[model samples]
Target: MNTPNPDTPNRDPSDDDLDHTVRPHDPADASSAPQRRFDAEVIPLRPADDDAPVHKDEDARAADIDTSFEVQLDPEPGAGPEPVDDGIGYLLDDPDGDAYPVIPENLRTLGGVGEAIARHTRRFAHRIAFHAVRTPRYGVLALLWSVVGVWRLGNRQLAWWWVSEQDYLRSLAVASGDSREWYRLHREVKETRRVRGLILAGQAFGVLAALLVMVSVAPWWAWAAVAAVGVPWLAHLGRPEDHPIIVPAMTVPRFRLLNHDVVLRAYYAAGLGHPDKPNQQVTFETTMSRTKEGQGSQVKVVLPHGKGFDAAVNAKKELASGLDVAPSQVYLTHDPSSHRRHTLTVMDRDPLAIPAGKTPLLDCKPRNIWQPAPFGLDEHSRKVTLSLLWISILIGAQPRKGKTFAARLLALYAALDARVRISVVDGKNSPDWNKFAMVAYHFIRGTVPNRAGDPVRQLIDALAEIKRHIIDTNEFLSTLSPEECPEGKLTEELCRKYPKRLFIWMLVMEEFQNYFELPDQDDNKQVAELLSFILAVGPSSGVILLSSSQKPSGVGAGDVQRLFNRYRDNHAVRFALRCGNRNVSDAILGGDAYSEGFDASALPVGKPYLGVGYLYGATDHTPTVRTHLADHGDAEKILTAARQLRERAGTLTGYAAGQDTTTPDRDVLADVLAVFGSDPGLHWNELADRLAGQIGDRWADVTADAISAQCRDLGVPSVDVKRAGVTRKGCRKQAVQAAADTAAAS
Candidate 1:
C-alpha cells in the first residue's frame, strides 16, 4: 500500500500507479435523484492508504486494534502474505469487549423513568390537542372536496367512454384528403367508444348498487365505513394538486434514524470522502447504533487515511447539512483511541429544544446532601445531577436567560437537605433570591442594607467565618482515627452528628460582579480575594460556593480583576445558559468546550428555551440541559419546607432564627423559638439541652428553669407536654413564636 503525507505539503508521484483504473457504475440502477446513491455492491477496492501517521514501524502498526483495511489480502491467490511487524500478532488472541447492558439506560434510574414519562406524556398530549382542535376544519373540507370528487369522477368516465383521444386522429385523416381513411378511422373510433361506454355504464351501475345495498340491507356501520374510505378518496383526488385537504397538526421533528448508509453519506457530502474514489472513502471504526438511552445514534468515525479529526470538526456545518438536521442536533465527541477517530452523534430531534419542565424538588422531599442533586435532563432525557461535595460550581449567562434561576435551583436542592447550611447573597439587590432567607443562615441582598445589614461587610464576615470553619473542620477531621473517619472527609453521618460544628455550607452569590465594583476599591479587592480563596479551598472542607454573574467579564482594575478571573475560571463545574457571545460562553464553560461543539450563544432563542444551557465540567458528557425551573412562588414553597426540616432537626441558626449573628445575642425568646422548630411543644429540659448544643456558648450553661423563667417574663405561656411515658411541664412553640413576634413588632 502506498501512502502520502498530508502534512508534508507535497505529493509523491510514485503513488499514482493506479490513476487510470476506472470504477464502473451500472446504468440500470440510475436514480432520478443524482446525489443519493444506493449501490448494493461495494465500490471496487483501490490501493488502501488505510491509516498511517508518518509510516510507523511495522511493529507499532501491528498493535493497532482495527485491522479492517488489510491491503490485497493473500498477496498470492490462496497464499498468506509475508509477515510484517515481527509476525507476533499471529499468536496473540484478542480480548473480548465488554457486553452491552441488559437493561436500557433510561429505565435504570427512577429520575430517568420520571423524565421519560413526563417528556413523552407532554408530547403525546400536545399532538392529541393539536389534531383535536383542527377536526372541525377537516370535516368541512372532506364534505366539500367529496362533492367535487363526484363531479370529477363522472367527467373522467365520460372522457373515457367518448374515446376523446382518437378525435384528433380522425381529423388528421380528413385533412390529408383521404375520405376512405377518415371513414375507416371514424368507424374504428365509434367501435372503441361503444365498448368503453358499455364498460363505463357497468362501473357506474356497480357503484350505485353498492351504495343502495349499504343504505338499505347493510348495517349502519357498513355505510359509515364506506363513507369513511370513499370520502377520503374523493377528497384526495379532487383537491388541487398543489394543496391538500388536511394540514399537519405539528411541525414534524427533523433528522432521520441513523444507519451506516446515512452516516457514510453525511461524511461524503461533508468532503470527508468520495463515493467513487475508494481510497478516499471514509471508514467506520465502529458500527452505528442507538445510544444507550435510545434517543440518538452514535458511531466512531475515522476520516479517510490522510485526513485528521479536525477536518471533520471544521466541516461540522456541512455535515449537518448533509444529514439535513439542525447543527445543534449534531454532537461530536473526541475519542482518545486516535486523533483520526471521533465519535459522531446525531439526535432524532434537537435536544436543547426539549423542555425539562419544573423541578422535582417541588414535592418538598427531604433529600440527602451527600448524593448528586437532580439538576435537569440531558440530551438523552437522562437525569443530569450535580454533586456539590468536594467541588464548586459557576453559573454564567446574560440577563433574563435564567442564569440566576439555574444557580438558585441548585441552592434550593441543598436547602431541602436539612443538614446543609445555606447562605444567600445577591449583589444586585434582586428580589428573586429574597425567599431563600427562610433557609439561609446568612442572607445578604446588596452592599447597602435591603434585607440584611451592610451586605458587603456581612458577606466579608461570612467568608471569614467560612474560611475559619474550613480550617477548623479540616483540623477536626485530622484528629479522628481511620476507624472513625476513614477517608479524612466529611460524611453524611458525621454532618448529622455535629450539624453546628461541621456544616455543609452553600454560599450562593447572584450577580456577584457587583461586589467587586463597589465604591470602595479596598472593599472590592477584599471581597474578590476572600471569594477566590473560598472557591479554591472551601469545597474540600464541605463548603460549596455557587457564584452566578451576568457580567463575568470587565469587573475591576488590576489585582481585583485578576483575582476575579481566577475565581471565575477555577470552578470545577460550570453551567452556561444562553450567554451573549462565544467569548462569554467560553468564559463560563472554558475554552475547550467550544472546540468540542458546545456554545451557549448558539442555543436556540425564545422564552421556551429559557433555563436551557450547556452543563460542562459537571459530568463526563457535557450535555445541553434544560435546567429545571422553580419560580418565585415555587421557591418560597420549597424553602419554607427546608426551614421546617431544619427546625425539626434543630439545625436552624444565624440570621434565619432572628439571631444577631454579626454580634453576640442573648435574646431568650428567639433562642427558644429557633430551637422549638416544628414541635407543638418541648419540655423545658429538652429545649434547654437542644439550645445548649445548637446555639453553642450562649446557652451552654443555661438551665431548664432559667429558660422557663425567661419565656414567662416575655409574656409566653407554659403547656402540658407528653413524654416517652409521662407528662411534663413545657412551653408551647406557638407561645414562644408569638412572644418573639410581639417583641419585634414593638
Candidate 2:
C-alpha cells in the first residue's frame, strides 16, 4: 500500500493513491463479491487535484488548500453579507442620536385674541361703572378743573417751548467741535426757533377755532361739551410724554412688555437655563393679555428638558428678581394642559400689600347655599370663594392668628342663608359668639353654666347634639328619591322642596382642641369619636362642620390623636393661618402640603394680616385669603338682618325659637306657665304634642314620658285632673304657676 501526501494540491492519483484514500477491504473471509463491492462503496474517496498550486513549504501549501475549500462553501443564495462594525463611526451616524430637544412654536392665537378682547371690555365697563357710582363729587371737581385747564392751554404751550429751547441750548453748550460745528449749531438753533414759533401760532389758532365752534353751537349743553372736550385736549397738550396729567386713584401695577428675550433672560437668571449650552432656550408659546386690572403679564413658557413644575415654582424668588419685582408680585404656576409648559405671571406691584377690604358677602345677591360663597380676595385680587355644599373644614393656627375669625366668617356666611341652620360651640366662651346665639340652633359656650360648671361638658353635649343632628339629616336624605337628590348629595332644590327637613346645617366648633384635650379621657375620646363620624358622613346630608384648633397635632389622649388626624383627613376644606411650624401647616392642610408650597407658617404675624391664611382643596391652587372682618357691631347687624330674613322665610327653628333648658337659671317652668296660661288642666300628652309642635322636627319625638321626666327634673308636679268631661293624668294650672313663681323667685 502507498501513502498519499496530504499537503499536495495538484498530484495526479494512481491506483495506489486510490487504495491509500479508500478503507482497506478484508478478502480472507470472502463472504461474496457483492460484499467486497459494498465495502468499497462505504468509503468516500476524493480524486487528487489535476491543476493546483504547489509550494516549496508544505505548511504554506496546506494553508492554500484549506482557504480554497472555504471559498467553495459559499453562503446561502440571496443571503446578504454581514454588516461590518465601523469603530465609533456607526454611533456618529445613528439617526436616533442624543441631542437637544426642539420645541415647536405655538401658532394657535385666535382664542387668545378673543380672551384679550373680552378682558379689556370687562375692565373698561368696570372702570366706567365704578367712577359713575362712587365718585360723583370727584367727577364734578374734575369737570371744574378741566375748565381751568382750557384757560391755561396757551401758558402750557409756552412752558413746553421754554423747556425745549433749554434742552437744545444745553446740548449746544455741551458740544465740542471746530468751526464746522459752530455753523451747524447756528443753523439748528435757527430751525428750532422757527418750529417753536409755528407751534405757538398753531396753538393760538386751535383755541380761536374752538371758541368759534362753541359760539356757533351756543346751546345749554354746548358749554358743558366745551368744558369736557377742551379740558382733555389742553390737558393732553400740557402732559409730559411719559406721565399722565391726572393721577389715578387706585395703585395700578405697571407691567413690563413681555418678549422672548425677557423670558429667556428670566429663565437664565432663575438657573433653569444652562449658560454654556445656548440651545437650552425657553420656548414661548404666545404672550397672553395683561391681567384684567393691568397688574401683570401672563406668559406661557415651555421649560428646558428634564426640568419640572416644582423647579419653576421653587425658583419664583429668582424669577421675581430677574423681572425686577417683589417675590409676591411674581407668580409661577404650572399649565396643567402640558407637562413641559408653565405660566409666568410678573406683576408690577405686590397685590397682597393692599388690604383686600371686607368680604363681598354683603354685596353678593342671594345665592344658593350649594354655590361657593365669596370668602375674600386671592393673591391676584381675584375673588376667592369657598363651596360649603358637601365638605367639612379644618382650620388651624396659633392663638390670636385669626383662626376664630375665619371660622366665624364661614359661620356668618352660612347664617345669611335662610335655608341654613347654624350651631356654634365656642370653647373660648368669648363674646365673639354672643350674637351668633340669636341665630344658631344650638349655641354651647362656657358661659352657659352646667351642673359641673365645666365648659368641656357643654362642648361634649354640643358634639353629641351635632351627631344626633347628623343621624336625623341622613335619615331624611335617605327618604328622598335619586331624581330629587342625585349623587346622594344635597342640592339647592332639595333645600327648597323640604325647607323644614333639608336645610343646610352648620356646626362651628371654635378652639376645638380644648374640647379634645380635656382632662377627662372619656370625654376627650367621646368628643373625638363624635367629630370623626360627623366629619366623615355629615357633608353629604347638608350638614357642615367647621372646626378651628390652635394645635392640630397630638391633640388628644391615647388613640384620640389618631382620631384627630382621621378627622383632619376627612375635612375636605382646610385653612391654616400663621402656624408656628410646617408640621402644623401639614397637619391642617395634609402631609407634604407645606413642602409643596401651601405653607401657612409663612404668613405674617399681627392684626393687619390676622385672618390671612393658606386655603387648600377649595381651588386648583392654594390661595392666601383674608377672611371678612365681622366685629361685634357688624355681627349684631348681620344677625339682625339674618334673623329677619329667616323669620320672613319661616325657617327659624330650635334655640332661636327661645327654648329653655332644664337648668335652674333657664328652666322650662316659665314656658310651662306660658303654655298653661290659667288653663286649669292640661294633659301630659297634650303638653308633649304642643311642645313638639313649637320646637320643630328636631324635637318631634317628644313624648309624655319625656315631658314627665323633664318636669321631675325641674321640680314641677303632675296630678290626675278632670277637664271637659274627661279625666286623665295631667298638671293643674296652679301647680305649673307655682313652679314658675318658684323658678322666678330663685
- Candidate topping lDDT: 1
Residue 153, model 2: lDDT of 71
Q: What is the lDDT of residue 212 in candidate 1?
A: 82
Number of backbone-clashing residue pairs for each candidate, in the order shown: 0, 0
lDDT of 2 by residue, 1-746 (tens): 12344646776645423324222333433333332222221313333453433466767645554443211122223334433335654344543122322521121367656756788899888778766675665555555656666567756667766545455554665575455765666677667778888888887899799889878877868888766676666556544567554445456654567666776787899988775686676777765657544567777788878877778877777887787777666766666666678767777666665666665555423446777877877776666788888888888899887777778777878888877888888877788898987777777775346753555545555665666667777787778788877767667777778776666788888877777776556566767787887888788777888988887877765678888778867788898888898787888889857445566765666666777888888766888786766666776777877888788888777678776321223346655565665577788888877766775333344457556656765676768877788888877777777776777789
As a whole number from 0 to 100, the lDDT of residue 404 in candidate 1 is 85
Reference-based TM-score, model 1: 0.64
lDDT of 1 by residue, 1-746 (tens): 32222223466655533322222343333333233323232223233353423334544333331232223321222322344445654665433222567876766889879977999999889888987888999889988988999899888888888888888888888889999999898888889988988898888799899878777899878878888999999988788887777677568755586788888888998988897886897878788787766678888887777887767777888998988888878888777677778889888888877788889999999998888988898777777888888888889888899988889889999999888888888888878988877878888887876544567767766776776788889999899889988998988787777766777899998888899898766677667877887888899899998989888888898988999999999999999999888888888899888777677887878887889888889767788888888899999999999999999988888889887665344788877878877888889889989997999656654456656766777898877889786789888888888888899999
By summed lDDT, the worst window of 10 consecutive residues in model 1 runs over: 65-74
Q: RMSD of candidate 1 to the true fold? A: 20.2
Candidate 2, pairs of clashing residues: none
